[model samples]
Target: IATRGLVDLPIDVLIRIAVRLPRVEAVARLACTCRDLHSPAFFEAAMRERTARRGGEVPLPSGRRRRETMVQALCRGERRDRFQRQNKIAAGDYHSVFVSEEGRLMTCGTHSFRDNPQPILGHSELDDEDLQVIGGDSVLVVPRPVAGLADVRVRTVATGYAHTLAVSEAGAVYSFGLGESGGLGHGNEADQHTPRVIESLRGVRAVAASGGLNHSLVLSAAGEVYSFGAGDRGQIGHDPESLFVPSRDRQEVTERLQLTPRVIDSLQGVRVVAVAAGAYHSLLLSEAQHVYSLGGGGATRRSSSRGRTSRFTGPQWTPQINEALRKVNVVAVSGGLGYSLVLSEQRHVYAFGNGSHGELGNGRDHSSTLYEFTSDGLQQINARIRAQQRALATTDAFGRHGYEVFRHSMTLADEAVPRLIESLGGVRVVGISAGGSMQTGGTGHSLVLSDEGEVYSFGCNGYGELGRNFDNESEELPTSVPHVVETLRGTRVVEIAAGGASSLAATATGAAYGWGRSECTGLREQVGERKSATPLRFADLELAHG
Candidate 1:
């Protein structure tokens, strides 16, 4: 028998050897050793073996297209194979989190007080070096396992303006990060740098949880609701009396803050199946298919029968039934800063509240010049102007107010109550997400995923959050995310998420894509471009795991 060197072996035999390599890196090194082993057929066979290891099929190249390598590196040099094991993902104002199959938690993006806190120029007077070392500001461009949470098995995760919440497989809740306004639900306003279980919920098994701008909601397995944090706007679902006792002389009611979880008495016997939180509002969907809304009521100034300004309107302090949606069999609900969306079993969609930026998808022409100013209309307009002034004074002090001014100038004909979004009548919507901070007057946006794996977006596109290639102009009606739909033509979208100014989508094949504002989270650089006008493949995402 003649002994032959490895490089002299036939391409087919060398490919078989390469496929047996334990790691993709190992196969790459083997290919580098011999020109014959570096052939496309060899790499393709190796890729097929890796796909089989990940429990997925390696899609054959279509037409003249070749099979591109599915594996890529994350920004921080972490392999995409590591991210393929994640089961869930969530995004906050400036950060994102992922949970692995083994329950390991990984986080990335800017988790700094400077990025998430309300813009207060003098909140910290530390020097640059001190701010970097002691201000609790940090950035992780690459996914890194959350420190001290190695042993805990996280089942799901949720993010808010400046904090994060994770539920364990054992039904225990863990909270961390900015704790201002009692958002941490720790019974005190103290920031938690590490994962800490909420002692009060030790005996209660939480099935679902949501985090808002400054509040949190937890749903128990028995359909009970628990809330804590800023209740000034009645987002906590407390009784109006408990929030504030109206006085004859005080024009402004002192907003109440809750530091610990409290049961929503109004929904004691109601079986709430799902809960969603906005900047200052909460939405609940019950087992009977009824929907309820709370908070954002105190912001509307209405004249009472006695001619005094009735600050409390509709359902602000209590979990009142949404009368407009009483006739619809609501199966899903999503809440934004100033609006809410509901999906019926029939796939019909309904929206309510502010639609100045077309967040409602009602197709109302906001640019019409027709003017009609009645006494009541004038009062409403004046109130809105006052509110806008206050918002500008605090945060948008030097920002543009053109959109606000134009929106206020138009007739106030947008939906204030639940109305059917006829534009999406034929499509079956299975998922929905809303972005923008209602409390901050940011032009909000909305996204919906249909049953056919298609995505539609409306509302603000100033930063290209809509992903329609149209800049600045808001979409008053739903439009398709063409790039995403075309790129993943044959794949079914499995999950979707919307952040303050960005959107994410994941396919059944485990592929991930993202678009929109990339500054705060450093996503622009990760996508290898500075502009985020269209969806880009998360090149580092590996969908297969062995």
Candidate 2:
């Protein structure tokens, strides 16, 4: 293998062929060719005799971890063997990147440059460019797809902080690039990298678009949910500078700037499936499994004896329904930058806001919001002593099923409600996701997703995204990556999503997996800063391999 000699092997087979070689930056340039294997005590006695002959673990040989998980399984098999390429890509450090698949739109990267990745300017499948104009370019840029919106087929895509939302397949809705506070609804504050069409929505089956350093959220498909750019901390419930809108019939609409699309009248029939956007606040998920919140009314509650005060602020124009979730049915909702999470369908999980770095798995501290009264505080005190001895007869009789919650975070200050992530006890949680990976030494974390797709990480692995390989260090809490994904262990994982730092999983045989921090998840040139990831498969699905 490499001309027979090369140090005549057997240093525990050269540390299992040097931990699957090639990386460690081409083996530190192949140990600087000589000087007795580049000093440093022969590379610390070959990692202390290969961590004392693997007791610390380093086996490979599952055909070399399937050829090093084939570089993210050949980039998800060439993005599902091309036909249109682009499976999914996300970014928010302003490095943009909102790519979706097959029936596309595209943008390149450049939140603030880090050496070449440029490919913006698109959207024009023709018809006199009816709706094109993607984005400008930034480093290495590579997005490219949007040409007149290729019949606007799209499946799902969301991005805020410069506007961009697409969700068509009859569920029609579209917008492109910046619209100031109106976030591109087209009525005023101008800016449109070209898609358009939000004709006040039509039937809207399912959609989610989010934002907060300004304001934005768009949830529809009957369950109603909507908001438009910057509402100060009212997060768009209205009145901080007018972009005011709130009327799925709940009607509030004022101060002017809704540029378009309105409906959230306190979520009428409720239906909403999912919607998350924070930096101020906004989260919604209800199919009966309720969870409705609206922008940082001063970040919510906190008295620990008056160290913080908004007097547990309230009234961001209204839409608060969290009363510690009545009976728990909500099924999936997420948000970041300030904190929020809810996933229930008996997979129970609830976290109010700001648990600092613990991201609300409830390790305590760091301001909590106003949804307290945690997870049925002992099943609501045992359903009020079984309804005062009438012996409670089935409201699902204290129903408690496969509880689960994937990932979360909130504390930047102010929290009054929401908290029930009891440190993941009983482990049935399906999936929760968060982001902002890579910042080692300074600590800046967030990443969670489980349903056995396993991958729990706590804030800022610096860049290793808490994959735990020690790229620097920063994990204030939440760290479960005990490696049982033996290529997705017993299968399951229906879906999962995360960003800011990166994490993803999908199964039930559709196959998809991800690691952390690197161009968010285009795999920064195939696994460069994945601090602790192991489930790197990325997709090969036709459903067979267990």
Candidate 3:
């Protein structure tokens, strides 16, 4: 039939032929030559064949609109995947943790670099002989599996500023890394270089766990919640009357140590099912689909309550069932820096807190509210700190970096209450994740997974956390990253995570992809200098023998 003409057969038959072709280039050439197969439908069907290659291990997305947008992207040849994925992924400030189906764990990136080197990679740095000092900074270019935990099967993992947590299938919790603020939950504030079970909660089966910048939360199989670490802003859900955390700056400093995991009595009989955290706040979900809020501190120092001042320059929000989300039927929640995301059972996304960098995804940012300071040494500098300059959106005043922050002129606005994202009204969202920190461009970003397995991102693109495919200039602009992640439209993302300035996605076929603000994550000098990243293979694998 092809000998006579490419269009001699039905379009469906032509599509089947194009999909079986081994090379994407071959499919591209054929689509160009045969006008009938050049359209989005044909391209989508062909690319979708990738799922069949996985032996139907994962299902296709459930939304037609998502399928169409994803296929259109595949037709444009925007995909570039070549590896498989792990069972689970947990992203943090500058590093990540991966748990494989084989019950093994691996981690990359670190919290320490030059002056005082620390091994927060869940492995030893001394064992790595070939570690390079590029541009006078130590850099971790690749991921390595952790050594311990050969006997236990890890089901989930979480990462914090300088620590890591692993929950075994047996519901046992293991922690490692920095011990400051009693983050390890071991009764003492001492760093654990290796995994150690929290002897205190050995009897209670922990079902889920989450970490904050300086605090942590744990949930029991029976619906009880436990919290520890710093509670200066009430992150450690304990009685305010008995709460006490050391704070040199605040005259109201408490005389108590936030050392061990204690049950949050307020959530008693509440049947809490899930937990999420950010730099200075935490969120809880009840079995009844109710959302709970706790802590509130970040980049902006504005107080939600008049004349009230707390740490991070705001009045602290105590743990309480959010009245606004009382009837929203929230299924999941995630937070970062000063903002939070709620995924409702109705496939709607609600955001609140900070919107200075567009983290809200409502098509509006605090650009209109930026206040400039004419202070000395406050030069126009890129907060993303890229090696090369991308397009710069006009702003009234630059942010604080090497200069004194108060000397810089800027204002961060708060959304105050959870509101539905009107722009995403048409898409059926299945998952939502948020990531951030105090970066020059606000660093907060949000990610949503459509029912069709497509990813949409908004907020700060200063660090490439949005992960938009730049194949077409019109579709993606680095200066203003779009909402939908076109590069991932074709892949059925089964898992996704957002960190301080990075994003991770795992496909239905078990392949993983990541992109975000890589500028000096405070661990590696080279990683901090943002640029189109592609580390030499040999260098990444040189110390692979370790």
Candidate 4:
């Protein structure tokens, strides 16, 4: 058949030949080889067949219109194959990172050149001159491979306010960027412009890691949790005694900082399977399906008999089990600046603390309503209701009026305890992501991906982070972002992430979509800009075909 005139073959035979080719690019290139075989119908059929075989939408051969693959739909503006190799994505307050299927890493967003000043250094065989800084001081508007890590096979990445951490396949952790407050786990308060291995964790195999504004957490293969960085608010999980000694002056530990990684002995016995970090708190999920929380007074505050707020303190501080989460086994957890979310074994989601921006997803705004009623006002309302009840005909009237008053009073109250997000009931939530913080001046938001491949976002949409089109408003209930749903209609969302005021979703086909806060680097626009509330497909990278 090769020796014969290939163009003379039957259309059916030609399609079979094209289908057998190893790559879509190959088939595309073949279509351009000769006019005899150049048929729009043939090309379209070949692409449709290839897409169908790869689990993509396939149109009917007769009368039905074809559906676009997530890739095709997202690659509209500029046609490039860079996104074809992306497998995972992480977003930070002002930057984003992408991990390719082959372990290559690419980053976009805000990065400082003042620290390094020099070109990025690495062990790649390529010459130093080859690794030049494209644009100095300007925000990286597109995803570009990090030079120094060219040889490092990155498995996952986590971004902080202004820093980045990457875990390699061998469990080696590399950190870079703002090291202030020790968020880099490098045992020093020095900024790093190039990727540097955290010498303290050199031999320790880290299975997972997360970064907060001024702190970092790493989970080892042995299930131990190591934390480093600022501990002023106990974000480092160190014992209070170790951090400050008894003093008659009773001075506050104003310089509370951990310059190196320290293991949290309190978690020694528990086999932690996952870890998450907020701006000032940390969450751990153990193998036994128990959730543990440490640090930050906002999320875990106890009112003492004296009516003063007391916080849990210690090195290996006894982690508080979210008491509101009883009977339900938690499988995953995420934290925002002052709020937390946990996914139960049954896929039910429970949220606690700070509903200020509706991050709690409980249909209330605590920021504006928390102080609406003072103690005196509540007493006055109770007195008026009691007086009114005395004049009522039956006790039922008082009961109904009292219930209404109670409901109204609690409407805007902060969820100091875990409360089931009733709006998400009946939807089997498989994953949860929370974003924004005081550090970034973001209103904060939350996102959850359902088992049915749908994503629901709520909370602050001030910058269109929720992908809801409208901005400056908040959604107290979980609402689906119609544009995102319609854009990637047939794709299954495998993972979801939330940044300062941005959201990202990765599909089963390795397609990645990002929306909100254009400064995060995932968007094509410049810093301080905003994009459509709908997710824009990443044009730089895509998952490589199997």
Candidate 5:
């Protein structure tokens, strides 16, 4: 029997195959190998998925060729995988979660080391509730299938600060973890040891979901955003006044809690296709390729000269489109501890908010090596530096902004405006991540996946999160680290996830590698002598995902 090329297959059949391949790179490769998939039928399939998820009537300009616009939306889920049909992996503050090829949810990491653990493993508290093995004084857990969701076919999984949210193929949303302040969306503030469907969202099928430090966001297939949990800083996208409840600690004071799934009225007509929950803020993306931010975006006021004054962008209880990100055509957005990020359609990464520990990835952080000013004086100098950057907005070929050399004086500066990372010049990046620094001094690192399947890591490496190992143990890590992670230098990473002080990358062949603090990474001692700075594969992860 002769072998027919995959490209010779029907357009519908090719699309079905693409949808099942689980990675966008595979689909792109298929199209590359066979030019037949470039026909209008294939483009239409891509167009249909984009339009359906974004709720946009116009995915293309008036006169562009199908091939031209087709490349724009290719590679991975643009809206933070808001419309992704399936997800293979997820990384949290202290756990690694995966959705197997068979649609089973697999998890590994420390779950509640302090005796009374939050049921983050997705195992029912009733059966999996035994105290974890006590290795000395630390509690450790082994990777296993989520017993509570054993029968349900989970499509995508998201790991939050201390919580987990799983979306089913049938569009059901199940949550487990620390449920304080109503983060669980169970109509009450109760921790779910096992996965439980949010009854209020039963009628509307959720396409994706995200969990913040103390909040939860669920996205509908129709491009609507539903929010719950602590609305103290407006992360939930609801009226700030209505979020106040009587404080349990004091009767005279109030607290924050939104117990049920409430559609964000502010984003009603806007059509939000994705959501990203930071430590205290939230980032949302619209179908129109615009990014929106809310909650406590730090009040780092910077005065600009060319009408680019920066103030508190939002605490907008109501979600509003970011004017700075208006024309960039943002495809993906991520939030972390005191910082946020956006990936442009051109593969350029823009960062703003806080660069305290170099999360901005522009190769600088608020350090004392170059500056002798006090904290207050440092803020003033930073304001001037940002003001100067805003004066000249012309971008070079590599998205590099032209600015005065005064950056030397104020070496330690935080980004008030969405600054384009000049260091990542000439690389067409495909994916990006910003990990939160909930533990350690600061692990708010950033990782960018390039078109060539290599990863560029920067920001904090307090626990070897950068994965760029050296010959000696004490090689002296840089203050603002930004370079291609050594272990992943030659490897082709299909997906990546950053956590508190660890980093994870998935290869095309289904192998996963992680590096960072020992407690978080699933890597075992046998993976090259347990070097924290080197990327190593965990046997448990291999067995689970494989």
Candidate 6:
């Protein structure tokens, strides 16, 4: 079949078939093999999925040509599997989650040592109660049920170090696991074994939940925000010294409860759209499309020649709006251990906080304490860097700006100032997530999802985070997955997140999938000793869309 001439399939039919093949590289090969396959019809199908409105008139495609464009793009791009309609992922350290459009959730990676790892509802349908068990060193998957979660039905879920929280159709909050520092919102010191409602909050419509090493945050539907858990280093956006702490007596038990979810005083009027938590920091995307940060405030007051600038750096007990994003509208937000990623509706991506392993997706190799780079514009900068080899200039101790020769190119270190990532350009990115310090193959890399549901990975792939099928090969730039995701070639993905060393993607249909480090891949049995290069579809995920 490889050498055969075009199979005489109808162009639209052929385009549909092309979109289903596992990976964009396969589509490219198809186009290369047959002249008829290269027709405009095929190209149109590939491109349509990436777009929402033609002529900005409606949400659906305008005609057959537009549909063909969507199909052809899937064949032409490097990450064709991501553009397909049947795949989604949910990732984290030691464990990952996958929610399918069918309404089922599948998990893999590290299992809790206290109990054997199994699908959250694989043994039986989930009842109203939640479950808890000790965590493990490797990845484990957990797929809980929403049988009686609430009237609204569970729309999303979030996990923390030892806790889990979910949002319902009625806009209420349900949480379980370690309640230390009020992570469970029980209003007192108590670990929850079942789903419990957070009574303090009402009249909510949407919620964004996030967890840290031991802390957590919940952004309410009304744009108000609440936080709890270990406040050490102010992970809860409250004074660490004021929150609960262990007593000097060995027998004493600290409640570690916040008692109630409090509205971040300064953020009250600013409606929040999204929230992300790291080991000790948190980021919130506001209704205004602005990014705000809290906890782990550091010395980010760098005096640039343009102005005396002060930005969020280290431990903070209060929320502060990201000054750099004040002028831009944020469409998406994601993070790993200590960094954050913001994708603007305009297709611009800005990374801040940490960049130790290049999780920031910037092309630098330093730690950024503040706004560092605009990633979406990387293509232009890489082009310029290729044209010139001029050394980076420096300024004096007085903070005066001047040009001087210095060191190497920026890789993925955290930037005190926003530095434009000059590698990913022209390509429209819809989602992005960060993983841990594990450098599987690349020097530094980040996983990104496109508007068409396609996935692209850059930075490090030493553990197959790049989905390249190798653990020793690391890249310094975004590398599109060459093949279509065989399991989910026609699914639509809504968002993606990375945890510890694995990755997770959620579909508009509610399905999810995972890949990467075994302990964090959310699987029961390890795939082998090697990190997973391609995403594995968990059988239990088929239940979500049901």
Best by lDDT: 5
Each prediction's number of clashing residue pairs: 0, 63, 5, 13, 0, 132
| Candidate 4 Cα outliers beyond 4 Å, as residue runs | 1-87, 112-137, 244-253, 302-317, 372-413, 439-442, 471-487, 522-529, 544-546
lDDT of 3 by residue, 1-546 (tens): 437677677778877897688767678788787676767667667766753463211122221123356554343222212111112777776566777646666666643466456656667543454244433445454556677776878877887766888888888998988887787899878888778898888899887788877788887877678888877566666655675455656543343446888888877667666788776678887655567777644422332333323223332435677777776657788877667888886788887765656777766664444335443322333332222222122221112122234333333344555768878888988778877754344457788888888888876654566765434543222222236776676667777777767777766665556666442222222433542221111122111011
Q: TM-score, each model?
A: 0.67, 0.31, 0.68, 0.67, 0.76, 0.62
- Using TM-score, rank the candidates from best to worst: 5, 3, 4, 1, 6, 2
| Tens digits of lDDT, candidate 6, 1-546 | 455336666677776776566655666687778676666567555445323221111111321123444443322222212321222344444445444354333444433344543322222333223232223332334554333342335556676655566665456777665565566666764776556777876666544577665567786645567876655445566655566655545533232335567666666456555677765567776544556676552212121324433443334567766676666546666655545667765666766644544555565442222223366444544454344321111211000122111111233344554434445566577666655432221123466666677776654444565555543423322342222334444667666666655566656554556665555653423434545666765554553443
**Residue 260 displacement in candidate 2 (angstroms):** 10
lDDT of 1: 0.60
Q: Model 3, 373: alpha-carbon shift in Å?
A: 12
- Residue 73 CA error for candidate 2 (Å)? 28
| After superposition, candidate 5 runs with Cα above 4 Å error | 1-86, 125-141, 250-254, 299-309, 368-411, 470-481, 524-531, 540-546
What's the residue-level lDDT of 308 in candidate 6? 31
For model 1, residues 154-177, the per-residue Cα lDDT tens digits are 877777766788888788888887
Cα lDDT for residue 110, candidate 6: 38
Query: On a 0 to 1 TM-score scale, where does candidate 3 land against the true structure?
Result: 0.68
lDDT of 4: 0.62
Report the alpha-carbon TM-score of model 1 versus the true structure: 0.67
- Provide the overall lDDT of each model, using Cα atoms, as 2-decimal numbers: 0.60, 0.46, 0.61, 0.62, 0.66, 0.50
Evaluate candidate 6 by giving its C-alpha RMSD to the native, one decimal. Answer: 14.3
Q: Mark the regions of model 2 whose C-alpha exceeds 4 Å error after superposition.
A: 1-148, 151-156, 159-164, 167-184, 188-233, 236-294, 298-310, 314-333, 336-339, 342-350, 353-420, 425-448, 454-489, 492-494, 497-505, 508-546
